[model samples]
Target: MMKMNDVAKLANVSPATVSRVICHPELVSEETRSKVLEVINQVNYKPHIVARQFRTQKTRNILVVVPDITSAFFSKVLRGIEHVALKNGYQVILGDTENNIEREKDYVDLLLQKQVDGMILLTARQDKVRLEELSTQFPLVLACEYIDGLNVPTVSIDNVSSARKATEHLISLGHTKIAHISGSINVILSRDRLRGFKQAMMSQNLEVESSYIQEGDFKFESGYHQMMKLLALEVPPTAVFAFNDEMALGAIKAAKDSGVNVPNDLAVVGFDNIKMSSINEPSITTIDQPKYEIGKKAMEILLKLINNQELHNKKIVFKDELIVRGSTRKEIDVKETLEMV
Candidate 1:
């Protein structure tokens, strides 16, 4: 029940001096600061955070827009975002859009209404005009997904090049009959990855079969179903490159159910090396995206924007690694890894 005035009286300082000591200590003399701190400890006073935020016109809350919260790959990224946000004295508000445009707009409204300080968008919405307009209006950063025309700061890997490297790995292993399972065609990353797969195939003088390319929705179920269709082909593919780990695992399961031996009869490669990929029956060979690093870097850039600082780069690309595992070649024993766990 102690107020700022009460602390001021105990410290024998004016109310304004007490306010300066509490909110902006650098503005007050060190002697005055010491007296205020001593009195504050005796009173055990806590600043009213909400009232302070209102006075400064800042919520100190960041809105992170996610396409799907259940995604294992995204979970790591979210952990990174939360870590940076907390360390920087800011709070994160997750906006799980579930790939819904209406829900995305709702989060945008929150930012426009001054409910949050800034935003980091993980969902890649195709509304270029809207995004571009918003970029000029407020502090915005895109992580894991991006649009070309927008001048907003973005943190992402080169999807096309990463996909190309994965496909090339399969080709180096002498796989001529290679198939591709891509995320939805609407997504820019999906399209870039598919383009990379095609580039790798053409480099080896192999035919890019129409029947071998399957479009999926970046879900486990879709991966399973699309893979089944690929398996049903008259001339089944010897290797498959899936867009994500979730879909890649699904493809592997389908191959097993159909009595196909993985890496022996059918080799599989996937993007986004999520945690589950390492412990699965056949540890998946995947493109290792720096998921946590991406989130950390994105939040860092958002903070720069929030502080009205100039950014060095608007489009930031991180490196990607191709990890070889049992799905492509024997790496670890599933039973042994499980036992270690």
Candidate 2:
């Protein structure tokens, strides 16, 4: 019931002084601030946040665009984003595009309409021209994926190199007949990871068999189907590499359904070491991407852009780690690692 004017009148200060005391405390004299605080406490006054936002021309709401909200990997990343956003007095709005470019564009329209302060995209599907144009007019940061020509800041690990390292690990373990379960070819990340897999095979003089490669939509069902197809092949792969832990877990299931024991009969590896990777029946050997850090760092970059600060780097690439687990432990001779090359 108590309003700003009522507080000012009770404190014997003008309304403008009261506004300054509430919005910018430092702008008010100490005496004026103390008096206003006493009145505010006595009245239990609550500032109108929406009105304040309107006056300041800032919603203090950040939009985070993700490919899929159901994916555990993106959920983990969102936790990091929420941590940073909350600590800095901002709110986060999630936009799950479900890998649809048109849906992603709809979320971008929120930024253009001043409904959100800024945006952090997790593997954006929008065209380069539109995204580039938006970047010039808004604060935008890319997380987990990047486009080469866009000058917008990005936070991600090197997908190609990480994929190469993962493939190399399988090769070192003497998995010459290796099959790759790749993500959708439409995204740059899938293409880069596929390239890495091929490069590693080439370095070891292993043949990259076309039949051994399968395309997945980065879902558990796709992984299950692909693994089944691979198992039915005349010359089945000794080991399988999946683009994500979801697929890796799927492959493990398919191998078991076919009465095959993991790591013994068929070795399997995955990328994006999500929480389920460790808790699975046979834990997956995987490329550990810093998912949480990527989200946190992406929000940090977006904040800097919103504050009109110069970014130290346009592209921030975090390092990926390889975690060996129970999923792929078929050991081979150390000398064979050399022989394989």
Instruction: List TM-score per model, in order.
Output: 0.86, 0.86
Give the range where candidate 1 is weakest over 10 consecutive residues by summed lDDT.
Answer: 19-28
* Native RMSD of candidate 1 (Å): 5.8
lDDT, model 1: 0.90
Residue 135 of model 2, lDDT score: 94
Clashing pairs in 2: none
List the RMSD of every prediction in angstroms. 5.8, 5.5
Q: lDDT tens digits, residues 1-341, model 1?
A: 99988998999999888877655454678788888888988989876878867666777789999999988889889989999886565789999998887899989999899889899999867488888888788899999999876777999999999999999999999999999999988889899999999999999899999999999999999889999999999999999999999999999999999998898889999999998889898999999999999999999999888888899888989999999999998445789899999
Instruction: Please provide, for model 2 over 1-341, each residue's C-alpha lDDT reduced to its tens digit, 9 standing for 90 to 100.
Output: 88989998999989888877765554567777888888988999887879977786777789999998899899878988999886565789999898998899899999999999899999666788888899999999999988877878888999999999999999998889999999999999999999999999999999999999999999998999999999999989999999999999999999999988899889899999999999998999999988888889988888888878888789999999999999888656689899999
Model 2, residue 64: what's the lDDT?
Answer: 94
lDDT of model 2, residue 294: 88
